[model samples]
Target chain A: MEVFIYGLARGSTLALMAVGFSFAYGVSRLPNFAHGAFYILAGFATWVFAQSLGLNYVLSIAISLVLLAAIGAAMYRFILIRVRGMEVSEIIASYALGVAILEALRCKFVGTGFSTPVFIEGTIKVAGVPIDLQRVVIIAGGVVVIGLIWAFTHYTRLGLSLRGIAQDERAALMLGIDSDRAATIALAIGSALAALAAVIILPVGSITVNEGYDVLISALAVCIIGGLGSWTGTILAAFILGFAGTLTATYIGTMWESVVVVAAIILVLLLKPSGLFGRQKEFEERV
Target chain B: MDILEVKDLMVFYENAIAINNVSIKCETGKVTGIFGSNSAGKSTLMYAISGIMMDMKRKEEMKGGERITVVGEMRLNGEDIMDIKPNDRARKGVVLCPERRRIFPESSVLENLKIGGYLASRSQAQETLKYVFTLFPALKDMKGKEGGFLSGGEQQMLAIGRALMAQPKLLLLDEPLLGLSPAMETRLAQAIKKINEQIGITILVAEQYARPILPVIDYGYVLENGGKVLEGTAQELIDNPDVKEAYFGV
Candidate 1:
């Protein structure tokens, strides 16, 4: 029961972390490897606002999300825009930028500790297993994000336009949905989502540069196992990885968590190269 | 009056010319046909008029790949629009029903139509959606079905219906009959005529097989190897020996 409860929390965290990355890739086809940077940066920014500047925590979160979104949009517009079609350059460029931001943050806060206050602070026993309210919040937050995204893509024009551009760029262009504009919106929204996840999860532990890299790894794993463009696949992959990690840690050893994640990625790759729901371009009907 | 006029348009990928000094015009409220065999620059010409070549050129440059050069004047309603972005041109009422029916495979038929109506106002989209359904009832029947699951004939009809949802003044259709049965081909050809006659939307259709299309076109141009080979009324093209033998396969 404890593993089950915690596994849900862990799975939701993974989903929140990767949803933005998956979404941006789906719409813009640009892999924002800087997703980790956005997450860590937002954490620090919120810390500074709420702790250092002594502002309202909620306001700090809102402001930090906006700033992160702007930064993300600028990154895509200036850097990723130049390498739109070259997949390797996009990966390298975004990853390098991510490393640069993280390293720069480390330089500033090396001697100091950064952490955000959780929205709620308490513990509750569920199924006789004590779970923190923060974990419940994380689970709830993840569900809300997923639901909002589903509604956004289904009911909103901008969301539909983004989905349209993602599906077929030429077809969307024919309908006056500009790919550049859509990509910019996607990057902004992607960054905001990453920040939202950061604010929710950073409360559980200290904000560390090490965790930024780990976040990136988790997101990549989720996206890869889910298939890059499949949202439902991302959620399912997150749960599978989360449960597997929790199970392995409980049964085998805590140290085997990372190993298990990597092994699962390799196994999935070997078994289903295009992912569970990913479109295998070579096999899909062209028309 | 001419709704679209391309004068001495030249397109090149690196050094290889895709469109070689081609000039064509589509009269307002009339169906103009551009016919050619495979590799005859028919698709290139369609892309050029719809302003998608600009996007292609931009993508190529961004990738540091082949240099795509498009030169010459293109006017939509007597205003020069040669260098505009594809989406902006679409906003200005030029839409392309791309070859091979590039409908959104993941989206349902209704969603596909809604995406096509991206530029229209809410009421306009609703009205056009109704019009589209009436024109292609199969699309209405498959409103809940994903586009990928549709048959080839149904896909082509959806493609045309999708284009109509865009509220276009000049519709550019590239190979609307590339892969379809004779019955479907004839039906789409008739639908194209109905769209022009009823809605009075100007159309420029490019196809390799000109048999069904030729019957509905007002004026036609024959393109061979990226250059214009012949230009005349539909009857005149039918009367021309080379066009009849090459396009009609008769």
Candidate 2:
């Protein structure tokens, strides 16, 4: 039961991470492979502001989110916008961003040692299992975040416009959805979610630039397993991967489990190229 | 007073000119038909007026000149609409249903209609949804179905219905009757007449199939090779032997 509780806690953080990837891809139609770099940067930024400076933990997180969102918006205007016209160019630019972010993070604080502050501290029991209070907080926070996003997309005009653009960009623009504004908003929201995930996960483990690739690969696998454009699919896929990974780790060595997990994802994609929940582009509109 | 006026509007694809110095006007409460052969810049003109062309310019390193403008010299009593944004243009009574029956493929039929009324309040949008459902009652049953699953005729209905949700003074429809059966065409034409006469909205329709549109259009412009070759009343153009040879080919 404790093992199950641990799996659920880890799944909550994975859900948060996958949600950002799915949300950004839905609205922007860009893979944003550099998203893991944003995850790493969020930890580094929060560490510098919140831990190093000893500022209020919440205030540092707020600063980290705003800073990362600005980075995302700037990248959109400068790099993404330039390459958006060419598919190959956009992918190449995204990888370039990833490399640059890794180098910048390495230069700043690898030696100084950066760590994110614990947002929720203590212990609690759930279903007769003793779980860290932070785990319960993570689960509750993930639910609230997901609920808020669903509400925002359904209830607000801007959110509706964003969803409209995701479905049909040109039509949305013709309807006056402001494709540029919608893209910016999606990027900002996606970046903030990534940051939140980093904060929640940090209490469980230390974060580092070298681990960036692991996060990227795991989040990407979750994205593909669930489907690239479906938010619900991403969260569900993350949970599936999390539980599956935990079960495999318990039975087998952790080293061999990653390979088995990836092979399973590959098998699923071979059967369904659009992922578990993604719709095939049959009759989809093209501009 | 003209609801929309385009003067010397030119659009180009890279180095090639798609539309050159094209100008036309639609007076209040009239259906103005733009008829053209394939590649005659009919759709290009529509894009320029509707602001779709403005977005294309950014990608091609092109810029819109000061010469081309939209919603000009029109008034509901005395307010100029040219100053309004494309979406706000709908609120101020100018709307475009668009060509190729651009329905939201993944959304429900009801959700598809709601897109047309993107600027309306929740209650207002819902009310407009009811009005549109009444016109195309086939949509009432399919509110939960994905738009892509609809038949071509039904998709066209949803498109027209979506545009009506905006409740505009001037509704611009591009190729509304394209890719449909003869029976469907007649039914759609009847639906359009009901919209104009009953709902009291002015319409401007562009078509390659001139026969179906000719019966309903008041004034017509015949375009050949991106230029206005002729302009006259529907009957006057029908009577002209030149129009018969070039357009009607009768």
Candidate 3:
């Protein structure tokens, strides 16, 4: 029960962290290295709004989400747009911006003191396993986010336009979707997702500059394992990694947990190069 | 009046000319066909008119390789659109059903149509979806199939149907019958005629083979080596011995 319940919590946390990065990359083919920056920045911004300004907690989160989305759109329009197709440059540019933001935050706040209040303050027993209410919320939030994303992509015009661009830019453009516009919208939504993940997950452990990097790594790991663009593959990967981590800690020492992740990635790469559900066509094209 | 007019158009990839000093006029509510063999610049002309040349130019600049230069005056509905983005051109009612049927491969047939309707209002989209279904009923049956899974003829139908969902004033078809059976070509040719007649949407189609389309086109141009060599009414082209020998295999 402990392994199952705790693993579920861990998996949800990962899903929240990674979905935004996967979404932006999948849609625009833009790997947002600043995704982690947005996550940490949201935590800090929400903290400033909620604690320093004495604003309502929910309102603070809402404001931060909007701000992060705008920042994301601006990032694409002003900076990343220029380096759109050049993959290597995109990574370097975004990663540099991410470092700048995170390092700036570290310089200013330098905190072990930054954290947010949980929305609900309690504990619940799931299958005879005691879990905090925030962890439970993260799990529920993960399910809800995935559901909303599925519906959005499947049913909505704007969402479908983004997916269309992801599949074929020329075809999408021929259909009257502004490829850049679709990319901008994708970046905005991705940033907001990062912010959402941060607000919900950061309360458990204090937000720090390093957590930003850690979040990005976790997101990257999950996305890679899940097969970069496969929606089902991401969730399944999250659970797989989640259970893998839990089992590692339970059987071997907690020290082996990190090794398991890297090893699994290497193993998957060696075996299925495109990740489990990854479309192999992209690889074939490159070859 | 001409819905689209290209004057003194020239395109270059560093030095080799793709299109040279080609001028063409497409009348409102008429099908104008441009026929050419491979690399004779039929696709390039379509790309130039649709503003995809500008798109490729930008992409090349970003890549810092293979500079593409397009110097041309393209007037759509009497407004100069020589340097506008492809999507903006699409919004302004010149939508291209690109060569090789570049439909979204991973997307379902229905989703492909829906994406094409991105610019349409909800009611317009609904009406156009019905129209597209009626025009290509084969598409209606395989609404849930991925576009890549469709046969070549079915894929061409989906591509045309998808473009129709955009509700363009001037539709551009670039080699719409590139890889299809003769029967399929004739069927698609009839459908193209119906689209022009029933909806009154102006069409500018580029083709390699003129037979399947000759019956449907009002005016046609023959292109060779990226330059316009001859053009006239379909009957006049049929009467010309050179065109008959070269194109009709007489």
Candidate 4:
């Protein structure tokens, strides 16, 4: 029961970290390598706003989210736009930006000493397992976010345009959807999502600059195992990895948790290069 | 008056000419056809007029792939649109039901229509949705099916219906009859005529096969090797021996 509850919470956290990455790739075909850096940046920004600048917690989170969204848009407008179609260049450019941001933060005052306060302080027992109220929030938040994303894509105009572009860019263009504008919106939304995940998850533990790389790795592993750009796949892969990590920590050792996640990714890639539900390249161009 | 006019248009990929000084006029509420064989620049002309060529050129340039040059004067409703973006062109009521029916394969038939109607007001979208269902009742049945799963003829119908949802003043159909049976071709040709007549939407259709399309077009241009070789009304084209031999297979 404990493993189940903890796995569920862990899976939700993984989903929160990876969904933005999958969404950005799905809409723009650009893998946002800086997703981890954005996550860490949001955590630090929120901390700076709330703790250092003496702003309200809710206001700090709101301001940091908006600022992260702008940074994401600028990242695309200035850097990613020039190298849009080249896959290698996109990966390189985004990864470079991510590394730069993370290393710069490390150079600054961000260290083991900084941590964000949790929204609520309480513990609840579900089936005799003591769980933090925030853990419950994480699981519920994940479902709500996924549901909202599904509804947005189905019912909203901008979301429909994003789906249209994702399927066939030129076709969307013929229909009057601007490709660059859609990509920019996608990047901004993706960054904001990263920030939201940070704000929610960072309160559980102290803010560490190295967690940026760990978050990126976790997100990449989940996305790769799930199938890049497949939201359902991301969720499924997250749960699989989440449970695997939890089970390994429970049985073998906590040191083997990261190993289990990485091993699953490698296994998935070796067995099915396109991941579980990834749209194959050959099928993409069918009329 | 012409709703769309292309005068002295030329397109080049690197140094090779794709469209050589081709000019065509589309009169309001009329069906204008351009017929050509493979590599005859029919698709290029359609792309140029719809402003997709500019996108292609930019993409190619960004990739350092090819040098594409387009020299043309495109006037839509007496307004010069040579420098406008493709989406802006679409907003100006010029929508392309692209070649090969590039409907969003992952999207359901209903969702595909909604995406096409991105530029329409709510009431306009609703009204057009009803009109599309009436025009192509087959699509009404498969409203929830993915576009990629539809049959060729059904996909063609969906493509046209989706374009109508855009509230286009001018609709460009690029090879709407490709890969369809003779019966399906004839049926689509009739539907094309109905759209032009019922909606009074000006159409510029480009096709390699002229037999089914030529009969329905009010005026047609025959393109050979990127240049306009012949042009006339349906009756005049049918009467010309060279046109008959080349296009009509008579």
- Each prediction's DockQ against the real complex: 0.71, 0.35, 0.60, 0.70
Error of 3 at B233 (Å): 0.5
**Candidate 4's residue-wise lDDT over A1-287, tens digit each?**
99999999999999999988888898999999999999999999999999999999999999999999999999999999999999999999999999999999998855489988988899999999999998888898889888989999999999999999988999899889999999999999999989999998999898888999999989999889988888789889999998998999899999998888878988999999988888776244333
Best by lDDT: 4
TM-score of each: 0.97, 0.87, 0.97, 0.98
lDDT of each: 0.91, 0.76, 0.91, 0.92
Tens digit of lDDT per residue, candidate 3, span B1-250? 9999999899999999999899999999999999888999999999898888888888999999888988878898799998789999999999999998887888899999999999999999999999999998888999999887888899899999999999899999999988789999999999999999999999999998889999999999999999999999999988999899887665
Deviation from native of the Cα of residue A118 in model 4, angstroms: 1.1
- Native contact fraction (fnat) of model 3: 0.78
Task: Give the TM-score comparing model 2 with the true structure, all chains together.
Answer: 0.87
Error of 3 at A116 (Å): 0.7
lDDT per residue as tens, model 2, B1-250: 7777766666666556667667778877878899988888888777666666656555444223323323223343246543455555556666777887777777777666666667777797877788888888888988888888888888889888877876677888888888899998998888887887777778888888788778888898988777778888999989999888777767
Tens-digit lDDT track of model 2 for A228-270: 8878788888888878877777788688778866886898799
**What local lDDT score does residue A136 receive in model 1, on the 0 to 100 scale?**
96
TM accuracy, model 3: 0.97
Please state the CAPRI-style docking class of candidate 4: medium
TM-score of 1: 0.97
Task: Write candidate 1's Cα lDDT for A1-287 as tens digits.
Answer: 98899899999999999999999998998888999988999999999999999999999999999998999899989998888888999999999999999999998887437789988989999989998999999999999999999999988889899999989888899889989899999999999999999999999989988788989889999999999888889999999999999999999999999999999999999999988767757235644
Clashing pairs in 3: none
Looking at model 2 chain A, report the run of 10 residues with the lowest lDDT sum. Answer: A110-119
How accurate is chain B of model 1, given as a TM-score from 0 to 1? 0.98
